[model samples]
Target: MKKNNSPFGIGGNKSTVSRREFLSKSFKATMATGIAMSGFPTILPASVFGKNAPSNRINIAAIGAGRISRGHDMPGVWQYDYAQLMAVCDLDSLRAEDGKKLINDYYTKRDGKPFDGVKAYTDYRELLQSKDIDAVLISTPDHTHAIIGVAAARAGKHIYMQKPASLTIKEGRIISDVVQKSGVKFQIGSQQRSSEQFRYAAELVRNGRIGELKTVYVGLPGDPSGGKKEEMPIPKNLNYDMWLAGTPEVYYTEERVHPQVGYGRPGWLRCEQFGAGMITGWGAHHIDSAHWGMGMERSGPVEVWCDKVDFATGGLWDVHGIFTTAAVYANGVKMIVSNEFQNGIKFEGTGGWIFVSRGDYQATSSDPTKPGPQAKKLDASNPKILQSVIGIKEFHFEISKEHHGNWLEAIRDNKSPIAPVEEAHRACSACLVHHIAMKLKRKLYWDPKKEEFKNDDEANKMLSRPQRNGYQVK
Candidate 1:
C-alpha cells in the first residue's frame, strides 16, 4: 500500500448538479415536442454543449491492483460514463502507483486537461474511510474478499465483487447478509449472465425449449500444483505481511505470491491459503450459468460426490491438481464437473443439447457426445437452435446485454442486478461445497434451504475454516 498523501481526486472540492441525463432526456423531449434550441434548428450539435460528457460520475475506489484490475475490471469501469476511478488501494506499492498513473492518464486524455487527483492508499480501510467514494470494485484474493466486502457494505458503499464470493460458505453467507442489510447494489462478476450465448442457453432451459433438462456438464480447467517451499527475502515495494493478512503467516517466496511489478499471472491464486483454485475461480462462472439455466440461482445442489484425489505435497502451493465433482439437484438434475471435458457448460435436455462458453456456442439434435469430439467439432448439427423463437408465456429475461451497464443501472434504480448478492452466494456455495466434497470424498447431502448438511456433523464442520490469528471478518 502506498502512503496516503493529499486525498481528494478530480471532483473533490465541488458539488455540482448533473445535467447529462437531464440534457439527454430533454433532447429526446425536444425532438418529440418539435422544440428547437433558439428556434434555429430542431437539434444542435452535441459538442456545442459537451452533451457527450457525463454530468455526474460516481466516484469509485478499486480494492485490488492485480492482473484483473489492470486487464479487465478497470477497463470495464472506464467504458461506462457513470463511473469515475478516483482511488486505488493495493498491498503492492508499485501496482498502486501504476493504477493511479493509469487513472490520471485516462481522464487527462478524455477531459483535455492534466488530471492527477487520483489518490493511492496501501490500506483499504483508509480508502473506505473516504466520503467521496460512492462505490468500490473488489478484485482481491478469495480469503480477503469477504472481509473487504463486508467492511465496504458497512461503510455504505456499493460493491462489485468478483467471482467466488468468499473463502468459505460461512463467509459468503455473512457477505450476503451484510450486503442486504446495507441496501447497497451488489453485482457479482459473473458476467456470463449478461452474455448472449449464456442468456440464450439458460432461456432455452427455463422456457422448456430444452424439455425437462436432465444433465448439465460444467468443464473447468485444472488447478496448479508443485511449487517449491524455498524461503526468500521479501521483494522491495511489496508488503508481504499485508498480503498474508487473514491467512496463516509463512515465509515469503516468489512462487507463493507474484512479482510486485510484473505483468504475469499471480501465484497466490494457486495456493490454498489464498485461493481455492479453479474449482472456485472458474467454477464460479460455469456453475453460476448452470444455476441460472436450472432456475436455481437462489438454491444449490442437494448432493455432491467426488472420488479420492491426492493433493500436491512437498510444496507451498497445495491446491488440488486434478479432480471431478458431480452434484445432483432435487429435481433429478445432474451436473458433472471436471477438467477432462471441453471447457464450457454442456446442457443436455430431453429435446436437444446446447453448449455455451466465453467464445463458443454449439447445439445439437442428437447427443452432443454422440459423433465423438472430432465430429462434434466439425458438424454444426442443430443450426436451427439459434433461430428458435421464444413465444409468449416462455422464459423472459431482464434486458442487460452488458454486465457493467446493468450494474450502473441497478445503482441508479436501487434495484437488484442480474447477479445479486444472494444469487452470488448460491453460485459460490456450489463451488465451495464441491471443493469440500473433493477433499472428503464423501456422499454428502445438502440442504440448500438451510445451507447445511443433513445431520452430517463432519460435513457441516467443513462449511467454514478456522480463521488464522487476527483474520476474522468483522
Candidate 2:
C-alpha cells in the first residue's frame, strides 16, 4: 500500500465541523439563531453566506480512480456546484495521479487559472482519516467494494458506490448493516433507476399498465472464455497486494488486472475471483430494474436454478458464459436472466408486455455486447400503454434524471435516494444466488427474509469467503 505521511493532504487544514455532521447540523444552528434574534445576523460566519460558499459545498473523495471513476462517478458529482472533488484514491499510483489531474484540470479550465486542490492518494484509509472529506464515490473492483464500503460507513462518510454492491452475499449484508447504523446516505450506482424509459416501464408495471406483472426477461452480456495465463512483472506504479484486497493472492499479470497503458475495460471483470462476470456486472443493472418494476426492490427470489451454464475452463478468465438462470420471487414473478435476450428487461403480464433498455447506449465501447438491430429503448405490446400518463393518485416512484445529483440531494436532506443500500443489497444478493446456483448446478431454495439458502449447508457456505492480506470486512 502507498504510505501516507499525513492524513490531511498537502497544506490542507481540518475543519471542526466534519463533512459528516455538516449535513445534519450545519443549517440548524443558523436557522435557530436567526429565529431567536430577529435583527441579528445568523450564527454562520460571513464567509458561508454566498451561493458558492465552501462550507455549503460537500467535499467528495473518489475511492477508486479507474475507468468508472473517471468516466462516470467523478464527472457525475463534480459537475454539480454543491459537490466538490476533494481527493482521489486508488491502489495504482498512476491512476490516482491521473484522477487528481483530471479533477484539477476541470477546475482550472472552469476558473481560468491553475487550480490544484485535489489530492491524490494510493491508500483510501488515509483519505478517510482526514476530516476534510464529507463523502466518497467508490468505483473499486467487486472484490474490494464491501471492505471499502464498510470502512467508509464506519468513518461517517456518505457513499455512492458502483453496482454489484459486494463480491459475496455475506459481505452485502455486512455493509448494508453498517451503513444503516451509520445513518449516512448511501446510493448504489444503478443508473437505470434515474433514466426516464426505465422509470416509465417500472411505473407502468407498478400501476397495472402491464396487468399482474407475471414475468421479467433480463438480458446481460457475457464475457469471453479466454485470457492470457502467463504471469507478468507487476508494474512499478501499481500496488498488486493492495489491489487484490481480501481475495486470494495470485501472480500479477496485465490480463489479470487492468491495462497499464490506458483505462480500457479491465480483465478482472471477467475473472471469477474478482467478479462473477456479467452475471453481477451487467445483471446488477438489469435485475435491479426488474425488481423495481415488480415492486420487489427490497425482496428477492424464493428459488433460483440454472441448468444451462458454461463455466469457462483452462483459462485465466473463468466466469460463466452463455448461461441462463431462472429466479422465482415470492410474488410469483419469474425472472429469466440470460444472454440470449436483447440486452435489456422485458416485463410480461396478462394484459401485455413492456421492454426497456439503453438502446445502443453502452457505458463503455469496450463492453462485449450491444443491443440487436431490432431492440428498442422503450416498447410495449399496445401503443396506448406507452402513452399512458401516471395520475397523482396512482402508484408513483421517485423521479430523478441525474443519479449523482439524487445522491447528493439525499445527503443534504438526510433522506433516502432513488436506490437505497438495502435495495442494492437485495439486487446484488439475487445475482449472487444465481451465480451460486449455476456453480452447484441445482435448484436452491432461498429465504428472502432470513437471507440464506434453505437447509443447504453446501450452498450457504459459499455465501462468504476468507479474507487475507489485512483486507477484511467486519
Candidate 3:
C-alpha cells in the first residue's frame, strides 16, 4: 500500500525504504566523522552530554510544533541527557521553521557550542523518513493521533504521543493492534501515571489501603465557552488543508486552527472535528488515573450513561460542552466522570478515601492505623498521608518521576514505557464512550473485551467516523 503524501523534496513517489538500510548508512556517516580518532562516534545527542555523561543517546523529532511543543514537549526533551531533538514537523511552515530556531538556540546556549542545521518539515511523513530520529513526540490533535501513531509504529520509531490515542473508540483499537504487533516502546502523555501523588493513590487503592475500592470520581475541566467564531481566509504561512489532514475539509478560521498572533492554545481543541472537547482533552489524564487506581487499566466499564450533554451555544466548534457520564464496570464499581470539579481523580473506598490532582493530594482514614486517606469533614492538613510509604510485597507501580525521560530510557532498553499503547487505548476508549452516550442520551452496555455495544448496532456504528478522501489509515 502507498504511504501518505510526502514533502516537496520527496514528491509523490512512494518508494519502499528498508529501515536497516537507512540506519546502517546513517550510522556509517556519523562514525566516519569521529572526533580524535577514538573509533567511538563523537556525534552524540545532547541527551547524553549533560550531568549524566557516557550514555547512548537516542535521536528524536517533534511531529506537532505548536504551543505544547514550545511550552512542554520540546523543552521536556532537553531535560534528559539521553534524548536528542533532530527535527520538527508542523502543517504551518512558519511555526515549523520557528520551532527549529527555538530548539537549536536552546542547545547552543546550554552546551556552549553552536548546534546548527536543525531540520524542519511541513509534512510529518518526510520527518519520519529520517533514520537519524530514533523516536518521535506526537502532540497533534485527537483526530490525527491514531493515523500518525500507527504510521510511526510501522516505521519502527518509538512514540511518546499525547493522550486519547483516538478520536473514536474503533480507531483506538486500530492503534492498539499496530503498536502491539510492532512491539515498539510507547508512552501515552497521560503524565499522571508518572507523578508521585497520582501513582501513590493508585498504589493505595490497588493495595487495598482504601479497603475495597467501590467508587471513583474523575473530575475533568469543562469545554471552552465562547461565541461563534467567524470564518476567515487562511493565513499565507499556515497550511489549513494540511492541518485538517484526517478530518473533513472545512472553511479556514483563526479560531479553528490556532490564534493568528502568538503560540497560544489552538482553537481546534474545542471543535468536534479535531477534538472530543475537554472530556478527552483533560479526561485522558484524570480518567486514566481513575482507571489505574481502580485496577481497571486493562479493562473498562461495562455500561455507561451520560446526561446534560451540551455543545457551545453558537460556534463552528460542535463538541460536547457540558456533561456528566456514569459507568459501571464488571466488578460492580461505579465511575463518575463530570466537568463539575477541577482536573483530578477521587477514589472512595469503604475504609478510606483519597483525592489527588497535580501538585497535591488529600487523604482521610477511618482506621487510625493507616495515615494515607482523606477525611470527609476535615481539610488535608496532616502530612502523614502524603508521606506514607508502601511496604514490601505491597503493590508498587513503576517509579517514573519524569514522563519523557522514562520513554527515552525505555527506548534505549527496548522495553515498554510506563504508559504503553494498550493501556492508553483502553483509557481513551472509556472517555470516548461518554461521547457515544451523550449523543444517544441513553444508557449503553459496552463489552470491553469484545469492544462493542451489546446488541446496539446504532451505537456501535458511532464507534468510528468517516474518513476524508486521501487520508484513510488503510
Candidate 4:
C-alpha cells in the first residue's frame, strides 16, 4: 500500500516506509513467532490473549497512581498484550485503591470474568520488593523522581519514569549513573521522541536539510499564579509526610499536593518546592525534542541565562510565571525557551526554518496549555523541504511508535530505549541550568563535561538540594 505524504519527511516517496508501520509489522511478527529475536527468555505457551507467551510478558508495577498515572501512564501499558500491570503503589491510600480498581476493572471487562490480581499499596518500598514485578512505571511528582528511580534500579527492575528526570542537576546525574551501572532498560516519558512529526523534524535538520542549524525555539506554557496558602486539614487517606519526600515539612494544603477528590491537574505542579513550573513540566518535552533535533542529546550548552523571569508572590505557588531562557552550545547553536512562542518548537538555520508542535496534542485535556494554531503541526520555509527523503546511508534515528511499547521492547532486547537515561539526564540538565540562571538573573558559564558551573561558587551551590532525613537519593 502506498503511504500518504507527511509534511515532516515521513512519507512522500514510494520507497519510504513510515516508522509507525515498520514498528507495527515488527510487533506483529514478534507476537506470531513468540520468539525473542535476541534469543533470551525460554518460550512458553501463548498468552491468554494469544499475543505472546505468558513467560515473555513483562509484569509492571505502577509507583504513582495520581493524575498522570491514572490518565496516561497506566493506560499506555495496561492495554498492551505483552505487558501486565501486577501492582500499584501510592502515598495516598485512596489513589492506590483507585489504581487497583482501574486496572482490575479493565481486565475484568475484557476477560469476561472477575480479575483481581492487581495489588495496591501505600508504600512504594513494599511494592518494589515484590518478586512478581519485572518493571515499574514512576509518574510521581518531580521532587521524588530521582530517589524512586534510584531505588527501582537497585531493585533490579526496569524503569519507565516521567521527565524532568530529576528535581536537581545532581540528582539527575546520580539517578542516571545508577541506572546505567545497574544495566536496566530505562525510558523517560519524553513522548515527543516517539512522535512522527517531532522525529521527522529532527531528521530534516540533522541531514542538513535546514543548512547549518543556528537557533532552536522552544515554547512552553506557564502555570497561572493562584494556589491557596492557608493550612488545611490533612486527608486521612494520604500519608502527607511520605508525600513530602525530601522537601521541607510544611502544613498540608490542597494547593501543596494533589486534589483529594479527583484526578485533576495537581497543585504541586505549580509549586517551586515540588517542581520548576512549566520550565521543567512542558519544557522537558519540548526541550528534549529540541536537543534531539539539535544533535545535543548527550551534550548540553556551554552557557545559560534568562533575559526575563517573573515569580508569583503572596501565594502557595511560587514557580516562574512569564519567562525567557537562552542557551549557547559549544558548537555555537543557540536555543531560546519562552512562553511567548506558540506551544511547540521551531528550528531555524541559514537555509530556512522548520516548526513542529503537538498541535492540540495534550497528555491530558486538563492541561491548560493549548496550541495557538492547530494547522501548524509541521511547517517549513519551503514546502519542498518537507518532501525530501532521508536516504538509508544518511543518519536515521531509532524509530519508536509508542513510548511504553518501546520500553518493553528494550527490556526484551536488552537495548537502549528511544529516550535513554543519559539523554534524559542531559536534556533535563539543560532545563535545570536554565532554571538556575533564571533564579540568579544572570548569565552563568557552565562546564557540561564536569556537570557544574564554571568557577562560580554561588551558582554551583544550587546544583543539588539537601534531602531531608529519610528521603535522600541513596
Model number with the top TM-score:
2
Write one digit per residue (lDDT tens) for candidate 3, span 399-429.
7777888787676555457888889998899
| lDDT for each residue of candidate 1 in 342-434, tens digit (9 for 90 to 100) | 778888888788877765332212112213333122111276665687665555566567777777767655556778899899999989989
Per-residue accuracy of model 2 over 365-410 as CA lDDT, tens digit each? 5756653474689999999999999876776677777899989878
**lDDT (10s digit) by residue, model 4, range 1-474:** 112133222322334443333554676677656656566665545343354645557889999998899889999998787789999999999999989999999999988999999999999898888877889999999999999999999998899999989999999999999999987889999999889999889989988998999999998876889889899999999999999999999999997899988888899999988889988998889889998888888888899999999999988889999999899999999999999877899999999999998887778769776535563789999999999998867777777788898888777655567888999999899999999999999999999999999989999999998889989986
RMSD of 4: 7.3
Q: Per-residue error at 455 for model 1, in Å?
A: 1.9
Using lDDT, give the best candidate's number: 2
lDDT of 3: 0.76
The reply for model 1, stretches above 4 Å from the true place, is: 1-55, 308-310, 360-381
Report the lDDT of model 3 for residue 317. 69
Model with the higher lDDT, candidate 2 or 4: 2
Model 2, position 252: C-alpha lDDT score: 95
**What overall lDDT, based on C-alpha atoms, would model 1 receive against the true structure?**
0.78
Cα lDDT computed for each candidate against the true fold: 0.78, 0.88, 0.76, 0.87
TM-score of each: 0.84, 0.91, 0.84, 0.90
For model 1, give the RMSD to the true fold: 9.5
Q: Could you give me the TM-score of model 2 versus the true structure? A: 0.91
